[model samples]
Target: MRMSEKRAKMVMSQFKFLFFVLNTTGLYVSHESRDASLGFMVQRIRQMKFVGSVALLAFGHRLTASGFTTSPHLSPCSQIQRQFGHSITNPTRFEASVTQRSLSTKPLEFPENPSPFSTIKNGILTLHHRLRNEEVLQWRALAFSFFSSLFLFRHAIDVKLASLWTFLTTSSSLIPRIFRTDSYEWVLAVSAFFFYIHFFWYADVSVRKASEQGKVHPWRKYRLQDRFEADKHRRSVELKLRRNGEIPSQNELVKNYSEVTKQTGWNWKAWTCEVWVYVVPLLTWDILSPRRHRRLAAFGAPTTIQVLRDITCGLLLYDILFFTGHILMHKIPLIYRTIHAKHHQEPEVRAGDVVRLSMVEEVLEVGFSIIALNLLGAHPISRSIYNLIITFLLTELHCGFDFPWTPQNVVPFGLATGSRRHHFHHRNGKHYYQKFFFHVDRLFGFFQKDDGSLHGDSVKPNPHIPPAWQ
Candidate 1:
């Protein structure tokens, strides 16, 4: 066979493949579905015809370049190209002809009246553009407020749903007593966990709001005084070192103790191990102790006043226990290094970091609170609400923001210890061991004021101590 015949066969094969692809994929059907307008369909047809003509002319040129002689019985496409003065003999002339033809062919023009569908589409696009412009003009304040409101509303709905679920699971005898115990405990546990996750989201918004405000409110400003003072003192020391022609060592420059030995990367294995170790034992205990579990599982609809009283008691009990544990964890270096120090790993804390703690430490921190509240004869609803409050406060403490509009500032003398205060504790573990109650630290002479005063008196500086006890 001639080389020209082989080249022509190859070109025909390529053309056949292209046609198959277009047909099998339903490309034309998709285009038709995209626009029902007659004008659009006509324009699409014209575009396809132009593309087909270009392809045929190019194929003819390839055949001529391979020294194929033109037969008298020429194909319809070759004849059409010859008629249009696009001969394959001169490649440049053929390209010029094709370009001129393409340029001269004007786009199809539709009637003055557009189709109803097209009109509706255009109207919708205009409305969307107008809304976007309006949103930009208003600085998105309305949109932000709307989203914030929606988030809070959704959280409220979730809380109600959780409460209903808890009530139903605890009250009903649909499941046997053996299974009921696990169900009741898990339902409450899962609900509390869900709320904990939700609080993290809320704290993110709170932090952003605080950043916008640019400063903490005067009411909670006292809580952060010590942190500010420490920062100023550190900077002054650094300046003195620079003046003395000595660069500060890494150890000297360390503001937060956690930063010194902080983990550089996440340990997924440790997290998974801790979760299993923590949850398994708790679940096992609940399953084994039928009497204790049944008593704890008892749910009742308490009065508003009763619920408020339970919350107050729960908060007080938690503060007392947490204060003791926190101080011991610091004083007895073993506990601080092994267990409590897990939470202090993040010097610059975030809202979601609330749950980032040692399994043993978490059990002691949260388990004690729950047990104490249950023993105090608090209703299930009250316990749930208390859990929610504690979760919110903990997340807020780590959220790294002190907005004026926060409940800590809005509610006069609210129990919230403020994020800055807790942040200082993470920075310098030697002071500020208390969580919710500031007075506890003051009473113990652990509270260091912004002016470098300990328990209302000037104190001499102490040397850095190792995290582990001797």
Candidate 2:
């Protein structure tokens, strides 16, 4: 009887364990399926909303036109009389003139049988017609590219979700398996790939778009004096060289120091090197880091304190590292000439020109920031947000257009280094090396004021400096 009781107990325990396993598995599958269904529903709802809005707008326009056509055409005096329910026996000259003017200005004519669907159909046709235009098509392509890049970065959200799921499932383990499935890894890899492609491709597209639209940089006029100063300096150097009986090379003497007005397009070789040397290493490090998962878990839905901590830590660390790297790149002549100067090739900076850095410069500037943030144990979501903030700032700085409504204009302090300041840096590389904030530049006396003038002692121009160095 004792043996039988022990056997029954063991059997019962085994059944309980089996049931637990089965229940957990079912829950996981159900949760995943539910999430997928929700995403599909959300997408469908957005499409419906867009269609409904378009339809409503078309209907509203049609109704407005019909209302105007059908409304009673009353003279100014008659309208007053009707409102008061009294007839005017005789009108003064002014009243008669006003009545005649009102009568002559007839309401627009409309079709007797106006089709409500006509406006909708016409709107659709007009959309199609616009899409058919080459310029419109190019704009659409650029917009698609920009949004696609953003969408790629959005996979980071998925990675966060996966990390959360993994943490929940494997909480007992010492190191959680955030990327348990092959799909998760692939998503990250693809995200990295798209990021590099976007960095390389989008700048050129943006430049082309800007050119087509005839949208000049808001601060471009400020650059006129700088250009004149540069030109004057160049002429003085050439004349001095000639007076010394040292003939400068024809190429050197006739060098164009003006900011580039046209798109320089892509440097395929540099881009390929950037992908292999910088992007690959960064992505690999990301894949290998378990801390990424921890960050995601901690920051997924942070409290107010956590939010502040992450932002503060991320900004300070990134700024210190990036500013240091930037200054070094400028101070080191060989690095500036061979590496940093690649970025300065386009003196006339555009939205797409932000990522146009040499492999080494890119690694030092962007890579260091990311690595330092990760090392600081920032939440994965915070790191992602930091990257986004950096991207927006850099893009806007290089974008040339300083719209009054931009964050830099609104904030006007802290990390909101205005586009004009950055443009000054691009125009004169000897000044403004700070990335996130202006204090570093101010501290180092390299700060360029809003008026495109340097704050500190001006550096003498080197005649031998390469054109790209500017």
Per-residue lDDT over 46-136 for candidate 1, one digit per residue giving the tens place of the 0 to 100 score:
3444465578677666666556744657753465466543322432342233334444343333444565899999998987787576433
Please, what are the lDDT tens digits per residue for candidate 2 over residues 233-338? Answer: 5667688899999987777665754444444454455445544665577557666763444434454443334434676677767777887877887889987898
* TM-scores for the candidates: 0.45, 0.43
Best by lDDT, which number?
Answer: 1
Pairs with backbone N, CA or C atoms under 3 Å apart (clashes), candidate 2: 203-352, 295-380
Model 1: colliding residue pairs: none
Best by TM-score: 1
